[model samples]
Target: MSRSAPASQGSVVLQTLAAGKLGVWPLVFTVLAAAAPLTVVGSGATTGWAVTAVTGIPVAYIAVAIALGLFAVGFVAMARRISHAGAFYTYVTRGLGRPFGVATAFMAVLAYNAMQIGLVGGFGYITAGFLDGHGITVPWWLIAGAGVVLVAVFGVSRIDLNGKVLATLLIAETVVALVLAIAQVTHPAGGTLTYTTLQPAGLLGDEAGTALAIAITGFVGIEGTAVFAEETKDPSRTVARATFIALAMICGLYAFCTWAISVATGPDQVVARATAEGPELTFNLAAPYVGAFIVTIGRLLLITSLFAAMLSFHNTAARYFYSLGREGILARWLGTTAPKSKAPRGGSLTQTGLAVIAVGCYAWFGWDPLTQMFFWLTVLGGFGVLLLMALTSTAVVAYFARLRTGDASGVTSSILTGVLAAVALGWISVQTVFDFNRLLGLAPDDPVARILPALYLAAAVAGLLWAGYLAARRPHVYRVIGDGAAAAIAPLTAVPHPAVPR
Candidate 1:
């Protein structure tokens, strides 16, 4: 394949990514690692109080899970056909066109970068607090900077190294959470098991939007299976299998833990207790049902969980850059990979640079590490993710509907699943935008909440216009936009020209 273009030619260069370094389980661990299972349980237990306080946080988790399952149907179908690191953006390009594809790619980079950088704040704060409890005090930035260095190192190493680290942490934390949750449900804190927690009324009315929004964010990295396709053993089967397994694990774990918490506190009182105690709600209940020692382990695991998420998002953001660079949408150097390690070294360093700047900005302005840095940025990232998923869902429908005449199969290429996922994600996108203030715990007119969503709009416009310019002036490059490096070369050879000299 043609991997590069000479600088004298004034054409974009592209490169193929490393391949076949991951298996199904490793990929599953990688994607689930990004979700930060323990962190979700701890935070959701508190954030969910708004909805479960009234009545369906457990149900909300299940509902969101169902929507994601439908999304997986069409998404996996596309993955089978197009095995690339670009994920949703690639699918959008093939199904829609190059311009829309580039637009999505730009949005993805912004969103994933926001999500990855935002996580460092939470990790640092939690690490600082955990250390403070041990009679050691350090500023959160110090801990965050230390993490950046560690993650930067890991990001440039082989991906399986990350898979091993994440799996170990994931298994430890998941076990602790499950043990406590089982104990809570098996014994019942108040000696009564109430079924009211499962009713739809619990998920309806005023705060349902907020509860659902939080639940959806727990699944943010679930789509990452598509992101690592280039490295997986069997791009099609492995990606799909790993995606399904990860989604099942995420949905089952999240719902069980949330329901178990309600069981421990009794559905009626869980909201008040969770709101008052925050993450302590789970530990306090676990101390009696399990043991103080186990609760301590769970708390410790919470810190590791954030680190796992940081690593996962770091890799994810790096791959987006690598893929975009390969498509000529970014600087060619961004696509370079380490030969021996098969790591996206250039992309990894870029992501690390971005993280440093974000942390520095937060430190310089003296923002609240937990609220401003963690909560605000993560929510913005989640909002961007929802928008992207909704667009991909539409793209899937459009991509397959075109094939309905004869070539496409009934089950694999049907537009039904895509429609279902698109509608579901589209509704959530709207809910998130309209209820942006509630999600951020801000008033309706808060500048931060109101202004952040507009950034996505700006990114989309800029990306589309940039793509339009390429389409008009550099049609050869435009033709190869999301088709990968080898595919890109096909266009350069086939570019049409005038039949005769003017």
Candidate 2:
């Protein structure tokens, strides 16, 4: 296979990333580190109050984590076969085709963008809210705008360095937060865990579905291992193990914490109480168990956690763009790597610029981050992920169908699992879009909610169009799309295209 035009001696950058910069443990820690605590204060928990709500906070955590693990059963297996920079897009592209692969890449880019942008919006809110309590109120966009700059700096830096910093921050924040949560639950000043909350009489009737929905939000970044495939030393073995480890850590931590908190609040009043208090219920409850100082630390950690998440996804989002561009789908610029650092400079810059632009627009319009930006972006982002998973699973089945006929290995089982995963994910995509009423206003004004998925569709269409154009003009790049060919899997380099074309 022809490499994307031959390498230029001076213009082309060489690979700086070794096969195994990150071991299994570090990789798992990096991905799950950002998502674990985010469940507590994200839009899901905040607005869950508006829905069915949960006061016995621990119960909510327990339920949400386990449900997310269900996705892992199929996701990890796919991870084993499709280890590349494009992650799901690569899997489907090889299993499916270049055109559909481009579509998946677009979906991933949008999904990751929605997630990162939400963090930016909400991080500002948390900071401003904390300040407001101190009798000082500033605008939310200003804080968000600042965060975009910080994220860009980190996003363009070395991935290993980012991993190290994340490990330190995550370890400190989760450990302290967990200690506080455990203490509060075990020896609550308020109440004790009992059958009331566990079997909460009307749980299934009312809060069951609602709790499950909110819980899914906590596991948002579990697929993050996909993003690190290029940086991973042994992607097949490392990523496979990392995915399960991430799953276990996230689920185990959240479930136990939730169960503990349920004990503290006493299950009977959990739903009503969590609902009344809104997003503040967990933090408020912690003040007594952990002390005011600990609560303050938690608030600061929340800000950092959000920033960490934003940074993490920003990197992942850039790779989606990078993969698409390398395949000649989007612009060719995103395909370029930076020399010396060997990062996806073009893609990272694009993501950062877009995010900054979004922050600017929200600021210009004087829009509220909590109400407009956070709510819409996060929910829609979730929808994009569902679509990507569904489509990628389909691609897996397509890729493996031929092999299954002659062989009796797990190939057949893999295809079957992919088929089921695709179906489930597709249903979720439809439900999420149709159920905008839960997040948006009760009436026609809810159009904004529907727009997120619409944006995803538009982006996917654009990507497909680009892929078609590439197919017409550059057949070589187009053919490499889903085949997992050697040329398409170029090493991360920083060199510019040679002025002399092949």
The candidate scoring highest on TM-score is 1
Model 2: lDDT of residue 181:
63
* TM-score versus the correct structure, for each prediction: 0.87, 0.81
Candidate 1 residue pairs in backbone clash: 55-202, 56-202
Segments of candidate 2 deviating more than 4 angstroms: 1-21, 36-44, 51-74, 82-85, 133-137, 159-161, 183-213, 229-236, 256-279, 405-408, 441-445, 482-485, 488-502
Clashes of each: 2, 15
How far does residue 357 in candidate 2 sit from its true spot (Å)? 2.0
Q: What are the per-residue Cα lDDT tens digits for candidate 1 across 1-502?
A: 6544533243333122223368899888878888988888876446446423434667777888888888888887776655443567777887777788888988989899988888898888778877887899999999999999999988898444466777888999899989978887886757988767667775566666656677777889989888767677667688889998998998999899888888888887887887677666777777876877898899899988888888888988998898777767788799899888899988999999999998898888998777667766776787788888889988888777765665665445348999999998888777777767777777778887778888898889988998988878877667677766554564555642211011
- Encode model 2's per-residue lDDT on 231-256: one tens digit a residue: 77666678778887777776666656
Candidate 1's TM-score reads 0.87
RMSD of each: 6.9, 7.1
lDDT of 1: 0.78
